[model samples]
Target: MSTEERPPKRPRNDYGSSDASGPPALQRSTDYWFDDGNIILQVESTQFRLAKSVLAMHSSVFRDMFSLPLPQDEPLVDGCPVVILCGDRSEDWTHLLAAVFPLQLFRTRNPTLDQLSAILRLSKKYDIPLPRSDCVRRLKCEFPTTLAEHDQLDTGWMHIEIPGDLSITQALVHLVNLAREVGLFSILPLLLYDIIIAAEPGENDHDNPNVLHHALRKLSTADEIACLRFHVRLMQPYHQTPLKWIESVPCVECTAAPKCSVKIDLLLGLALNAPNALIHEFLTQWDSHDDWSSKVCEKCLIVAKAVHETARQKFWDRLPSFFELPEWEELRKMDFE
Candidate 1:
């Protein structure tokens, strides 16, 4: 299959230490509870003695698995079943257990990117709704599905907290992988957009040995070309004249319509030099404009507002095509049920 057509691969996890013939040696965890626990779940070399009921409540997968009668040859620790789970990390189990138990306020707070990522993967895999939904909701908050949501945000929304020792580029790279792993495709466009932005001069090398490089390596030649084209488009100046439509609109409030037009035109010209200049940036600068609003008539402001909204919408409509993604309508439906 083509690289773009292939499914994203899950990162190799630490597990399966005791897949051999005999029962694995028990190394019960001191951190996790052992008293009144009915099961010992082994992830990698670490063993966690946790309540079966607690796990079953959060996860339908655990519930269904526990419902099955234990095999005659199954291993046991203190009469409790010792289920050795493979292809997962002990840290992931810790995060999952932390989220399910009342001992920690996992659900009542925002997690670090690493914690959130762990919760997302484990919750989705184990069919746990609360953590999974919260993770999805958090991602959607940053990577909104609709143009309306995106419009409300500023350039400030592009900056996120870089967790751990990772640079901004590395953090974004991790997010992209996490989004794909958890089936949260809605976040892909925003993540990819930000990655390209962060890869600018003095940020980080695209060829660096990170998740971002690996992701790029997985793209097909066509998708890579599309990405390059999209980057070029993002860098290009928004050269369309904002005065084109607003100048022709009737200015009823003032007899000095020509003067009003000159003021509005000057405002737009100044906005083009603003950092990361785009139609939205131009509109925002114009709308909150302290100087120009005083100079222009009310009719001028009204017409300018209409022109700005139209220009921003047009830009939004073309964004997905730049990255070779589906249209906005189709993109919004991507990860939904």
Candidate 2:
């Protein structure tokens, strides 16, 4: 049998080798060499495109600006297409409100609560934004019974996009805490608490939305009614009520809380000057009634005095007392140094 001379070593597909444009490690299955031989690899459509644009225009001006380009492959869309990262759904009232964007990633149109929740699950699994409209519409309509399974907080319309730095879980906890204090119902807060408890031993990476969802579902069986009652009672200590007050009052542009309000200065003073011991103690038991006057020196007291005088107190009281303090906030801030 004349061994058919192995079809002239089938001239290698141009994609088999790395070039300036192609990622060396793209799964060989998807790799293909174009006739022009300009190697290009697909990455997540949006970010990779963004990166490519930036690279084509500004790469030379800024040394190593786009060192690691994101993969630009067609999004995997079986049950739902999942992207692989999120920017913590940062917010501004004038900008896209935080709650609305994530669900749009799954579908450009409406999504129900369940679909939104499923999208969130996919976001956690693959590390993408939960902004898909399909996901949100799905979640809102289904009210995702599965959401109760996540460890991340679902306070209001919030979610844990990232895990650690402004994570979805943190957002959920904040929403729950805010709701508890603001009276949006413990439904969200209780949901967060259940998940926080449930995400046991899982790294607080904020990167893992699946684990976050897994923990949150524990709320389905939780005593939410009781927790709501407790929070209702808890509100009395501050003489404040629900978010309805703020919601009812249009969040109009008010120069009242300017970015550099004097309170911020006081906080900076505290961070730079206060005794670390005092700062640490205050944050450790922020909710407790430990008197700052007892630990803080006269200098910190001066900052505290300024802090008490600012309009920031209203917003401050909403957060934990330790966080409310200028010294604590100042110290905690990344730009403090």
Candidate 3:
């Protein structure tokens, strides 16, 4: 056998030549490429060209790692060093870098769940305070811990435009997972309530009816029970307690108040069949021209709405208790800053 031709050597970076046993160096991503970048961060096989100074300024971890004296034995490429970051996905690094880089990679702050998850995970791991804090702020803005915070949200059902392609359920599920991941426990009760609203038993869209089911399955048994308990409270008929107020409210529009009470009783009974009905859902129907409140006098409608609001607030104030969480005031007083 004649002598076999040896393959040419690959380019070496500050890290070293790629291990023969490992995969070859990945192609540099066009998205994150910086022509004047001083260093290449290699995560898995993928390469990210970035400024060491910027990274060091934002991350204590990076500062310490970069401060270590370089060995003469280390490899170099294109007069730049290669820093191999093991145990991280290139996809995550891409999102993390996008958040830090001066250039706006994406047009909006509304990052997808995957993007948020990756950014949060890497930012925490790298001890990059800004990205970590940014992620939490964005999440908290979307899933407020208190009713006041919830009402202050600029976009409500009237402005139900979500930032990205995600549905309300998907966004809520993402928040639930993110809150759990980052130990933002205070937001869980509200998030779970939103998820329950989406997972209404029978009338939910078949396209992804089980999104809540799948998300709930990830919870501990106690948490699951807490969610179910809250759902039960939400769906429980208030015919005897609150619905009876309809009969008590004086209405001149009808001569037969007792018969009108029967009609209101029947209308409120509809909630018993609706597993996902919220106070607002029933109130909206009642206020509409087609429901029992429509037949009642304007005074009756006003009283009914006021009573409904009070009842809804009472239920809301007790939400944390249903989930075995601390009081809302306690959650509000605890500062993350």
Question: Top TM-score: which candidate number?
Answer: 3
Instruction: Compute each candidate's TM-score over C-alphas.
Output: 0.71, 0.22, 0.73
Global CA lDDT computed for model 1: 0.66
TM-score, cand. 3: 0.73
List ranges where model 3 is wrong by over 4 Å. Answer: 1-24, 71-74, 102-109, 152-171, 202-212, 219-222, 239-256, 273-295, 332-337
Q: Looking at model 3, report the run of 10 residues with the lowest lDDT sum.
A: 279-288
Best candidate according to lDDT: 3
Clashes of each: 0, 70, 3
Q: Is candidate 1 or candidate 2 better by lDDT?
A: 1
Candidate 3 lDDT over residue span 131-213, tens digit each: 77876776667766655566566545321234567666666766676666666777777777777766664444657656556
Which regions in candidate 1 have their CA more than 4 angstroms from the true location?
A: 1-27, 104-109, 151-164, 198-226, 240-298
Q: Please, what are the lDDT tens digits per residue for candidate 1 over residues 69-166?
A: 98897656677888878998888878766666647544345567777788888887788998778667777887776667865676643323445577
Query: Tens-digit lDDT track for model 2 on 29-124?
Result: 112222332223233222111223322342242224334553565333322222333432211110221233233545343433233344344333
